[model samples]
Target: MRTYLAARAACIVFLFSGSAAAAVSEEEFAQLRAEMLRLAERVGVLEEENRELRQVAEATVSEVQLARTEAQEAGRTVEEWAPGTTFSGDFRYRYEEIDVESRDIRSRHRLRARFGAVARLSNDVEIGLRLAAGSESPVSGNTTLGSGGTSKDLYLDQAYAKWRPFNGAYVTAGKMKNNFYRPGGAGLAWDSDYTPEGLAFGWSGEQLFINAAAIGLESDSRRDNHTFYYGLQGGARLPVGDTVSITAGAAYFDVPVQGESSFFGDADDFFGNSFNCTDADNCAYLLDYEELELFAELTYSGFAMPLNFYADYIRNLDADTYDTGWLAGARLGKASAAGSWQVGYQYEDVEADSVLALLRDSNVGGGGSDIQGHKLFGSYAVARDWTVGFTVFVDNDAGENRTGSGTDYDRVVFDTIFKY
Candidate 1:
């Protein structure tokens, strides 16, 4: 544009200086100069408008790119939501044999399968559900194989919701997992598969922990018919040194026995607890359970294999006799990964009324109280998520008083388990 303006100015100057000036008037030259100035101003306005349009186009392109990026990010957020929901399960097959003195030996092939799902609804809330292949037994999930290949049944094992109101504290409701910690993972006070229905509270810190629960044993609209179990436990972990630590805790549990028959057992059943016979066919519990428990565990990892020693003691304050029970055990190594193995031994003496009969270890003493036993167990991880194990229980009925009333009981179990 500058070059065009300069050429126009030169042409006009040449025209005026040559013979054309003789015929042209001064008025014509003045009009021509004014027209050239207006034309230059118009060109400058057009250039400014063009620059503004170019900037607008660049900004529109940038906005479109940003919108596209945001859409992709929204798609990824939707994909990430599914990961917050997870599924897990395990399967176990076992061959079990039990022998009782003066009785025929019993053998069975049993299998247990459990599938569970957990959904993290938010940062502070979660929901869980599980299904198990077995009968509606709180202490066991196993189904014996028999009945000419009849199809097994599935039962609702767990349905619960958990909420974390703050750091290191949580509340659980519904038919939830047992919230109390079993020292040494022992089933002296509570069974491994027991899912109690009610509300539970728990809190844990670096070295201290507490658990409490209100378990619903039975619900009846009739007065004094409802039964509930209440439990509270507090513990602390203390470090002896860098390679050794000790954990100790105490717990109290109250189980109400209001009627002759409860949800767990029939009127004729005592399960080694003291009972009074109302008639030839009816019996009632003698006392309510007020159990106090003490537990301790010591772990040492200074050697090639870790060693763990644990003890559990319980006393029913409501009973005068057969009220004390205790167990001591030691375990060497851990079978957590492939090619690893573990071996453990434990001895336990549980007199009548020491703990609740239906809630204690079902695998010992024919699933009742008044038992003294030695348990030897070992496990080997054959592959990832797969393990083989065995347990042998040499137990006797402590309630038997006659000379060898022939109540010696022995049980052996071999299991193959797979987890996913």
Candidate 2:
């Protein structure tokens, strides 16, 4: 019995000690689990921070690349905006000698000088201006003016603004040469010797082109009281092929005459009688006049010798008359060729009762007998920007009129031009 009791006691003690050790071990395991959970949370936070930093770095890199691309594109655009800006000018000096067979005596030598400037103001605009100084010698006569005078009267050969607002439309204003007839010598026929201040508007599209304007006129001895001269013109250019073009145009002018009397020897005389009538009864005897001009031209640039043909008709509304003229010409020169030449023949027919009759009857030897004229011109490129040229002009009446005698006139001109 004693042995059994001792063994039982020892077993009880062992059970208690084992229970205490299990409790302590459980506590240590709980602490270790807590530490492991904290470590995991810290590692998760670090991972999140790394992901955010990577996103930020990627965003910054993308922004920098975009900026670089935009800068390069802007640089390319600037280069294309203004392809070229060029400066160019020209100088022309002409010496003329004249002999009038009808006047019996010859005139002195005349000198002329002209300067011009052409500039590219912008991608769509161009500007030009010119200054000329010379004696006013008639193409056929021995009269010269403004020879020894001051050069203060510098004419504005071209002071205008041009804009290409659309793909095929252009507008210009401020004292430009009028576009009346086709772009040829005939087109320049009515341009004022002195530049006139005016406004011109033009429109051009794929199939059509039209230009119109109104201008101011300077009063002269003939029409001393004239306030303004207005004109309207329209033109159309049609392309027949890659190198040929046909153009047609019409022009009208309205002029008011005041101050001075008698139509003879007056510039306004071509329109109608210049008699000032204070009473309606006297005004009934005067004829009101308006002038109309119609013109057409054909240009061919495909051949070895480019050819141009022009025809024009003028009608006096009140005088009930008409005049017709035509010109056929060719330019046989190349910009890179050694020699260049231009030859033309012009025929101007004026009836006995036409407006040109007054100029004919003034003994200016230009009227009344069906005037025919011929022109021969040639030019040689002595240097890159220097050229020398000569021209001869002759006019003769074919002797078809029985009431008036025929007249004949001849003229020769030489020119030298240098440009840069």
Candidate 3:
């Protein structure tokens, strides 16, 4: 019985040992599978992180390029806004030592200084101002309001507002110099010394051009008075070819002169005598007068030598009879090959009548008012911005009454100008 019991115990021990070994193998296999799954999950997380980083890098690069492009566009905008802003001006000083061989005045020395400024306000607008210092006013005779001494005056040489509302039309308003006379090489009138407050309109296209203006005339003394005069002017320029052009224009003015009044104390003896009149001795009185002027100009600039000729007829519209006066003038000028030197000749003639007679006799009158004149002028460029000029002017009295005391007068002038 003891031997059978020992054998059974040994069999149970063997069975239990085998079962424990099997359990141990299963646990090891399960641990290995779990570790492999954990490694795969980690690899997937790393790959996703890499993809996100790449997207962020690409987005950052795109933003940087956009910023660079915007900076370039802003710089271009600024460059266009201030294109070609420039400054320019000129200074002219002239000395005229006059030795009048006539009996009116023996000798005189005159000095003139001029300064001007031109500014480009925008692509289509510009402003300018000119100041002058001299012994005489810009009036033809160089007359002064007060004493004959050096004086400084500010002239609105070009104080006008200009605008190009359309591609081919421009309008301007303010005090503007008159365009009645062409730009001549000589003569004070050609200098645009007289500027009237007015409005001007101009239009130009490929083959057509027109300019019209209406001006207000004011007295030299009472500038602010509401009393005023009006003038109408218009012109057209036609091109015949690449080198030839023709222009024509007309102007009309209505001037009103103020009347004078006086008070006569009461009671002269009754005129038992009455005034009588007959057709042969008829006399009439009027309180007002009007002046009218007509003008034309022809220019040939395409010729081997350029030339300009102009004429005008003036009449007293309110006079008792039909009396008319006229003016005729011509100019010739040439430029050197290098455009450094310019020479010119000018001739002007004036005819006399009743109105001209009164004007010539006025205190502010220069002999040229009713006289013929000729001018010879030359200018040389000393530097890019400097020029020296000389002019000789001669006048002859060709009036009905020999109104200018002398038959001839002459003057010579020298000038230098610098530009900035």
Each model's C-alpha lDDT?
0.85, 0.52, 0.50
Clash number by candidate, in order: 0, 0, 0
The prediction achieving the highest TM-score against the true structure is 1
Each model's TM-score, in the order given? 0.78, 0.57, 0.55
Candidate 2 lDDT, 1-420, residue by residue in tens:
346445555644544475644755767756755665565566667768878999999999999999998898787742355444334455555555443446553433434445655466777786656655542311211123444764433444567777777776666766555544444554213422334456666676665666665655433535543345566777788999799898887877654433433333333233222234565323211333355677777888988867777776655565543233333455454333445545555545544322323212211123232444565666777776778887565564433342355445555667777776
lDDT of 3 by residue, 1-420 (tens): 235435544544543465644755767645744664565566567768878999999999999999998898787742365553434455666666444454554333434445555456776775555555532222322323345554555444456667777788877777654534443322322233445466777777764555566655333454332334454555666666776665655555454432311011112210110112334333211222244655565677766667776665555565444234454556554443334666666555543321323212111113323445666777877776778888776653434333335355666778776776
Query: Candidate 1: where is the Cα deviation over 4 Å?
Result: 1-81, 222-225, 258-260, 280-282, 401-406
> Mind giving the per-residue lDDT tens digits that candidate 1 earns over 1-420?
567667766766765575666667888867766776677677778768878999999999999999998898787743375767888899999999999887899999999999998899999999999999987778899999999999999999999999999999999998889999887788888889898999999999999999999998775647343787899999999999789999999999999783545455465666677777778656667788899999999999998888999999999999887788899999999887899989999998888888887788888767667888889999999987999999999865545521234378899999999999
Candidate with maximal lDDT: 1
The candidate 2 region of ten consecutive residues with least summed lDDT is: 135-144
Error of 3 at 35 (Å): 60
- Write down the TM-score for model 1: 0.78
User: lDDT-based ranking, best first?
Assistant: 1, 2, 3
The runs of at least 3 residues in candidate 2 whose Cα sits more than 4 Å from the true structure, single-residue gaps closed, are: 1-88, 97-101, 105-108, 116-128, 135-153, 187-194, 219-224, 241-243, 258-289, 321-338, 350-372, 396-407
- In lDDT terms, how accurate is model 1? 0.85
Give the TM-score comparing model 3 with the true structure, all chains together.
Answer: 0.55
